[model samples]
Target: MGNAVISSDKWHPVLDRCLTISGEEEEEAFQLLENLASFMLPYEISASPLLQQMWYIIDNTKYDGNDKRLKALSVLTELSMGSADKMQLLIDSNKNARQVLALLLCRGKFDVRQQVLVILRNMLINLPSSIPFLVERQTVIGVSDLLTVMHPDTVILALEAMKAILENGGSPMTPENNEPSFSLLAEEASVHSRLDFLVSSPNEHVALLAMEILHEYIDPNDDDIILPDDLIDLTLHPLS
Candidate 1:
């Protein structure tokens, strides 16, 4: 289905239905959009009105119930996956895109927040330009809080996203090195403390990832760093 030669015009009806959908029809409309998004080319999706409609559904709080918002986020995640242009279009088309995503990260349900993290991670990976926008206070704090979630997958996603942000944003230049860094984000008390706590997580993969981020970005001079036995074993043997 991904290679099916569907004209751009074919998306119009679906876009129209999604744009005007309401009440009970909202779920069906989003479901249809999600299916279309899965196989649609990034350029085709960007050229159509689909992104705007999805943003409308996502930004409007009235669509929060009936799982409509989650569906919208799912569609977005699929659309933004491997295309830097699509990710850029989503950010450029909506001035408040970052804020809306931050709100979802902070207030949405577990699934919803997980979808948002996926979208942010995709953005950080595909579109380096999104770093400055996504690295702001609310977004950073929201991602930082996810480290404490009970779910390891969600925590891993958040950690990976933070790692990408730090890698791309880079730290400020010091006397030792001339290159800038994203240390400001890593240095945030909330984010730094969370990494410190996560370094000892029972999940060895989680602890290793957290430790890698700290080792690369964080100042090593901090006090009270505790290394767990699992981390020691994993560090020596490493995850295969």
Candidate 2:
């Protein structure tokens, strides 16, 4: 670890060299830097510099040459270790993080998207009051786009986030309706398309969750379903 720490400043050179090599040499450079990052995890100073280099390498890879996306993500958590500012950096650095997360829902392989999703979910979960207002301003715009692209995994994770919104409950600015609309039944909710997208997922876990909610809407024995006697009270009256 100590040796790796000394070499941390030299990471940009190593990453640059790694990009030039082919076959085993290239692979070795990748492994070396990866291992170096792992060893530096205990030290914040070392990790931050190394991560900045990784992000730079990854960003540069966009113009020409080989793959660096995976590596950027590999050390993403380490880069942002306990930093509240990490989310903002992701949003700023990666313009497509949101779009790709939506696109990658129907398509997987981008594990970075999942890590990014975790960050987004945490943001929503931590700031419940602020999120609905955020949602109103299009926080959930990605969910609709992901569905159109048939990205079920992204959709499912997003729905889990949306369910929190539903649990907390808010209404979008609609043409009419004075009351707050939890009414996924209403035209404003976009419920049917949302329903169709999730229900079609081949992943059993995804499909099962979709079915659970679908049942809530169309349950034959309506009496078999349960509703909080005070759902409105729970969601509507937000205490200061």
Highest-TM-score candidate: 1
Candidate 1 residue runs with Cα over 4 Å from true position = 2-5, 19-28, 170-182, 220-240
* Colliding residue pairs in candidate 1: 170-181, 170-182, 171-180, 171-181, 171-182, 172-181
**What is residue 134's positional error in candidate 2, in angstroms?**
12
Q: In the order shown, what is each candidate's alpha-carbon RMSD?
A: 6.1, 9.2
lDDT tens digits by residue: candidate 1, 1-240:
444534447556766776566776877767767777766666777677777877888888777754767778888887666456666776777877777897888888878888888888778766777776655555676888898899997898888888878777553222123423455644662788888788889987888888877876675455544444555442211010
The C-alpha stretches of model 2 lying farther than 4 A from their native spots are 1-12, 42-48, 61-65, 77-144, 147-192, 200-202, 210-240
Candidate 2, residues 70-186, lDDT tens digits: the string is 544455433333333543443444544444333332233445445444444554454454343334323344443343445665666655555555556566433123434544422
In model 2, the clashing pairs are 105-151, 106-151
lDDT for 52 in candidate 2 is 55
